[model samples]
Target chain A: MGQFFVFIKKEFYHIFRDRWTMIILLILPVIMLTLFGFAITTEVKNTKLGVFDPSKDIATRSIIQRLQANEYFILKKFISNPDRIEDEFQRGEVGLIIVFPEKFYENLLHTGEGQIQLITDGSDPNNAITLTNYATNIVASYQQELNKTAVIPYQIVPEIKLLYNPRLKGAYNFVPGIMGMILMLICAMMTSVAIAREKEKGTMELLLVSPMKPLVVILSKVVPYFFVSIINLATILLLSVYVLEVPVTGSLFWLIIISLIYIFLSLALGILISSLVNSQVVALLISGAVLMMPVLLLSGMIFPVESMPYLLQLLSNAVPARWFIMAIKKLMIKGLDVTSIYKELIILGSMAFFFIVVSLKTFKNRL
Target chain B: MQVIEAENLTKRFGKFTAVDSISFDVKEGEIFGFLGANGAGKTTAMRMLCGLIKPTSGQGIVAGYDIKKQSENVKANIGYMSQRFSIYEDLKVWENLRLFAGIYGIPNRKINDRIDELLKRLGFESEKDTLVKSLPLGWKQKLAFLVAIVHEPKVVFLDEPTGGVDPASRRQFWELIYEATDRGITVFVTTHYMEEAEYCNRVSIMVDGRIEAMDSPRNLKNKFEAESMDEVFHKLARKSTRTGD
Candidate 1:
């Protein structure tokens, strides 16, 4: 036990003593969270909208006023004819077009009914969806204002219930995903490079010949990274709650437990990579290039899994980060319990066990 | 007393045998020199004796432990320094000493004392604060040697320990080996420098994965009818056909 402590202290010194690694470990998570949360956002600002109002009446102008009052859109073009909507869309001059039909005001005043069509460019689905929703909300509010004074015999009233996120903010989605990403970065890539450095320097032989068992050597190398990742986890969680306003409505303790399990699995993977490679550059390349792309692209961190093809969806099932992102979303946003996250816990646990077994076997086999 | 005894210790990688049924004994407290050409099996035999790898078909005992059955025990009682200067270059000299000492299970209270003794004895008192990377090559080799045997193991293995050090430092390294042997620590040293073999109490020459000659440096020279151990080595190594390792 004392030996383990000594080894851990040595490992920590190695990590903290190197200024570059310390910077990456201590500051990189916060920087990434802040960057993604503030600078790199998916929420579109000043989206271009083309208004095609053939009615040229009071109700049409009121509807456009209501849409313009919101900050998400700017009326970039006013299409005189309905055919010009396609031209504006194709020219990329506008993302959406609102067409109020002819006699829109007269029909509304006489029968308390009118038709409004929303046409959006589908090239960018996320932008198109938001734009259409904004137009629908503006039209609905206009109808509500008219109904306060006028009589409408038949009305279609729809109530929207936002289950977890009433505001539907994008930061809430990325905070949990970023947590998984930064954990993988610190635990997997950093540790693999550190161990490979020992092998490159030929110190691994000295370690192997020492009385400290191989298991002890590997565990000691990974223990410091485990704690560092936990620190990263804590920092990211605090930023999500306090800065980004993404609360952990579920059990925070369970969230930490599952995340620790993930950190263990990532550290074991790092050791496994270290055992296979002999140089730090190769270790960095493997961990940084090979592992990073999959964690970013296939893990559904920034992209939705359902939107991917069938083959990719099946491929994502094999990515542990995808499940972790889902599990964290449940815990932080949806406020689910431990039973709700059991599947993710089981998968992460099995991965941790698998990596430990494989890395130990390879470590025994390799130099 | 023999600290290491190997009889018919063979290690075969598929069809090619690395150590071919060689037999030798290393006394408890003496420098035993192992010499070989580049492709010869000195490293393979040393690894087997250190219990880094199991022998294919042989019997061996190191530090009163079976090389195969008690591999971990053999490891616990021996130290190893590779030709690559296995010191952590990024670590300060004192920290390296501390790490190896800790690995050898030295008590925390005694670690600083062991380190101070080593620094004073190696004439490295001034370099206690220096990183191994900033030190000269000779000093690094010496510190690596000192750290390898810091646990006071019964036997220490040096595999081509003086490959790149200057002649002066090589001589100084041998003096450290003499100090280790005087303290009853067996030193199994491999070297490319033939003059280093003369310092050993006994020297064994390997050719084509087998021990071709084994005796004191003087006896081997006289028996080969050569003036020095260098000629004795050439006379035997000339028979080998295999190339670089």
Candidate 2:
């Protein structure tokens, strides 16, 4: 036990003594959280819209006013010529265009319906779809309000409810996902590279020849990283709550327990990687390519797993980050209990055991 | 007791045999020099004895532990200084010493005292607080050697411990090795310098994964009919390469 503490103390010194690694470990989580929180949004806002209203009437003006009233779109220009709409969208100055046809009020009075064309740039199809949907809802609501007084036997009412994310806040969705990715990268990737560095530098042989048992040496190397990863977890949670205003709906204790479990699994994975690879560069490349990329892409962090292709969905099931993201979402968004996440917990546990066993076996075989 | 005893020990990595069926014994409290050029099997044989690598087929006992079955025990009773100065460059000199000492389970007070003695003896007392990266290459090499033997293991393996040091520093380093051996610790060292082998009580010369010659420096010189150990080494190396074809 005394030897173990000594080894752990040395590991901490190695981590803290390097200014670059220390700075990166301390600052990266905060930077990524802030960037992803503010920049990634499911609810599109301040989108540029061009208006081509040829009918200069009161009703047409009222319809344009309703579109401008919504915060989702910012009215960029009112072009008299319809030909200018294509130029505005082509220059990327406008994401959406609203055209009110000639004699729009007269047609509405006579036919009880007016034609409005919504043209949106579909280069980024997801954003375009969102903007179009927002525009349609706003127009439908305005038409409904205008027709409220008329006694119509037939009416179409639209009911909408947001699933998964009710409030449609960007931070609420990204904070938990970023938390999982950052923890995994820090605990697994960093620790693996650090251990592989010892091997590359030929220090591992020196350490193995010492009286300390191999298990103790490995545990000591991982414990400091575990604590550092937890600190990052806390920092992200704090930033989410205070800076981004994302609420922690679940029990804080449960969140901590699950996050810690994931961190341990990541660290074990790092040790396993270190045992397999001989150089730090190889270890970093392997971890980033094999672990980090999949976590970011397939863990439902940036893209929904269900929305992905069939092959990707099947691939994501094998990624530990997917389970971590699911577990975190349940804890942070749904406020679920331990019992609710038993299946994810079991998978993470099995992965942790597998990595630990493989790493120990590799270590023994190398010796 | 023999610190190391190998009986026809061999190690093969795939089709390449790193350490062929070679046998030798290292007596207790003796400085055994393992001499070879680049690509020689000195490192592989040393690794097998240090329990860092397993032999493909053979029998050996290192520090009273079976080389095949009780490798962990063998590792516990030995110290290894690799060809590279493997000390942590980010750590201070004292921190490096304390870390190795702690890993060996030395008591804190004893570790402190031992570190103080070692620093003073090596004339590094003033640089104890400095990071190892700031130290000169020769100082780092010497410090690595000191740390390897700090736990006072029964046998210490030095793999090219003086590879890049200047003559004066090499002399100083050998002095420390001699001092450790005088304390009844066995020293198993490998070197490319033939002169360094002359200082060993017994020396083994390896070529193409086998020891072509093993004896004292004077005896090897007489057998090869050479004036110096260097001549003896060159003659054997050339003869082995000629026969290798």
Candidate 3:
């Protein structure tokens, strides 16, 4: 244990004394957190809106007021002529336009039905579709208020509630994915490059000839990365909660425990990679180009797994980040307990065990 | 006391043999030079004896431990230096000393003093805090040798320890090797420079994965009817099927 601590201290020296490594370890997490927090979103906010209310009646004004009061849209200018509505949208000044018909309030009072035109820029189909949904919901709420006392045919009513993320803020999803990605970056990539560096420098031969056991040497190399990964986890968590307003509704202790397990698995993968490759460049490339892309695409960070093709869904199972992200989402977003995530934890545990076994076997074969 | 004894030590990779049935013995407090042209199996034989790899078929004892069965024991009792500078270049001189000392099971209270004594004796006191990478190649090689034998092992194996060093630094490195042998640590070193073979008490020449000649320099010179080890090596190495040097 004393020797192991000494090795760990040297590993830390390697990390701290190098300026490039220190920058990557310290600054990369903040950059990735801010980037993912801001970029990863599909929900529209503060969209530019224009309205051409030709009727200008009480009901049409009331519906427009509801849309403007919400955080989804900022009412730009009112267009007097209908022709100018398209001109404004074409100028990129407005993402959506609300046009109330000439008899909007009269039709609502006498016939109990009205027409409201929702014209939107269709350059981005996704943005257009989401904006349309927002406009439709606002108009529907206004109609419900108008029909509070009116008797009509019996209708089936449905009530909906979102469980984990009530606000559906993108940061809630991104925070967990960031935790998975940053931990992999720090633990797996750093450790593999470190070990491969020793091999490339011929220091691994000196280590092999020493009295230090190979297992102890590998463990010592991983210790500093494991601690650094925890620091990154804390960084992402604090930033998400305090700055981004994404709260951790679950037990903080359980969240840390799961993250620690994930860090260990990543470190094991690093050891396995270092054992297989001899050059630091190869190690860096494999860990970055090979491991990182799968983590990014298949981990359900940017894309949902269920919506993917069936083949891709099966391929996602091979990505350790997929399970880690899933488990973290349940704990941080769903506020679930440890027992609730036994399946994900089991998969991560097995993967860690497999990597460790393969790494040890490779070391033994070399010996 | 023979510190290293090997007979019929062989290593094969698939169908090709890298080290073919080589044999040698070195006594305590001796400088045994391992001389070979490139691809002549000097490194392969040394690696087997150092317990870095298993020999295909051999009977060997290193520091009173079997090379095959008690390879771990052999490892514990031997120090190894490679052609490349093996010390941690990113670490300071004293920190590298502390790391090797700690791993070799040296006591904590003695580590600082040991490092201080090493620096003082080697006339490198001013470089205690300098990073190893900042030092010249010659200094790094010397430090690697010092670190390898930090535990005072029974024997030290050096693989081309002075490959790219200048003549002045090479002279200083040889002095350090002599100092180590005077303290009764067996020295097993491999070198490409035939002139270095003259400094060893006994030298062996390897050609085509086998030892073509093993004897004192003078005897080897007399047997080959050559004046220097370089000429002797040229005569024997000319018979090689691989390289007709």
Candidate 4:
């Protein structure tokens, strides 16, 4: 035990003495948090809006008032001629335009026929889709208000209700993903590189010839990286709560317990990688290409797994981060208790067990 | 008493025989030189003695512990210094010493005093806190040798410990080796430098994964009809069928 402590102290000295490693360990989490929180966002607000309403009737005016009153749009200008709509879009001053035909109110009241057009910049497809959806919802709501006084037969309206993230904030989605990514970054990548460094420098041979057990050497190497990962976890959670306004409404204790399990799995993976490779550059390449790439692309961090190809979705099931991110989303955003996340807990727990067993076996076998 | 005993110790990697049925013994407190050219199986044999690798087929004992069955005990009772710099370059002088001593299971109270004595003896009291990377290569090599034996093991294996040192530093390194032998510590060292072999009490020359000749340097010179250990080594190494590793 004393030997273990001494080895851990040496590991810390290695980390603290190197400026680049210190920066990566302590500051990179904050940078990733802010980058995901504020910089990369899907929620668009305060979009400049253009209008071409020739009738200027009370009904058209009410819809215009509703769009302006909401937070998504700003009334930039009213184009006079329909022919100039193309020129208005070419100016690029506004992202969306609304045009109501002449005699809109008269058509709706007397003949029960009205047409309103919503045009958006399709170059940015995601933004265009969101804007179109918001406009359609507002128009549907206005029609519903009209239908309350006069019943219209054979008119079907679909109701779409979002459950957990009602406002569709990107923070709610990415906070869990950032936790998965940063934990893997610190625990797996750093630990592997650190162990491989000893081998590369010939220090591992010295260590092997000593009285210390192989287990002690490996445990000591990972302990410091594990603590750093915990600090990163706290940084991510704190930033998500205070800065991004994403809260942990479920049991904090269970959330932490699950995160610790995932951390253990990552550490085991690091040991496995270090055992297979004898140099730091190879360790870094494997961790970056094999570990980080899967965590980023296939773990459902940036894309939905269900929408992917069948083979890819099957491959994602093997990624430990997918289970961790799923459980985190449940606990943080949906505010689900532990019972609701039993599937995720079981999957992550088994993966941790499997990785630890395989890594230990390979560690002993390789030497 | 023999500190290391090997009977037909052999290691094979697939079809390649790295160390083939080599047998040897070394008495306590003697500087036993392991001489070989590149890929002459010098490292492979040293690794087996230090309990770092498993022998394919052999009977061996290191520090009274069976190399195969009690490798942990063998490891505890032995010290090893490799051709490469084994100490952590980023760590301070004292930190490297303390780390190795602690790993060897030296009592906590004895480590500081031992470190102090080492630093003082090496005239490094003022540089205890200095990072090892900044030290001169010779000083680093000397420090590595000291750190390896901090626990006072029965046997110390040095694999080309003075590989790249200047002649003066190499001379001082041999003085340290003499000092270690005076303390009754058996030294097993490998070197490419022929003059360094003359300093060893006994020298063994390996050719083609086998020891061709082993005797006192004076005896080896008389038997081979050569004036220097270099001529004696070349006489045996010329029979090697294998190329450099």
**TM-score of chain A by itself in each prediction:** 0.87, 0.88, 0.92, 0.93
Q: List candidate 1 stretches off by more than 4 Å.
A: A48-65, A74-103, A117-123, A148-163
Question: Each prediction's DockQ?
Answer: 0.70, 0.64, 0.81, 0.84
lDDT of 3 by residue, B154-241 (tens): 9999999998899999999999999999889999999989899999999999999999999999999999899899999999888878
What does candidate 1's lDDT look like per residue over B128-184, in tens digits?
A: 999888999989999999988889999999999999888999899889999999999
- List ranges where model 3 is wrong by over 4 Å: A147-166, B243-245
- lDDT by residue for model 2 over B161-225, one digit each (tens)? 99878999899899989998989999999998888989999999998888899999999999999
Which stretch of 10 consecutive residues in model 1 chain A shows the poorest summed lDDT?
A153-162
lDDT tens string, model 1, A1-367?
Answer: 7678888888887887799999999999999999888778776667787888878898899889878877878988788877667788778898778888889888877766788888987878877776676667667777778778765533464534346875557788789889888998898899999999988888888988887788888888888888888788989998988998889999999999989888887888888888889999999899887677778988898778999999999988888888888899999999999999999999988988998889889988885
Give the lDDT of residue A55 in candidate 3: 86
| Candidate 2 total steric clashes | 0
Q: What is the DockQ of candidate 3?
A: 0.81
Candidate 4, superposed: residue stretches over 4 Å from native = A105-114, A138-159
| Candidate 4 all-Cα RMSD | 2.2
Residue A50, candidate 2: how far off, in angstroms?
A: 4.5
Measured on C-alpha atoms, candidate 4 has an lDDT of 0.91
Per-prediction TM-score:
0.91, 0.88, 0.95, 0.95
Report backbone clashes per prediction. 0, 0, 0, 0
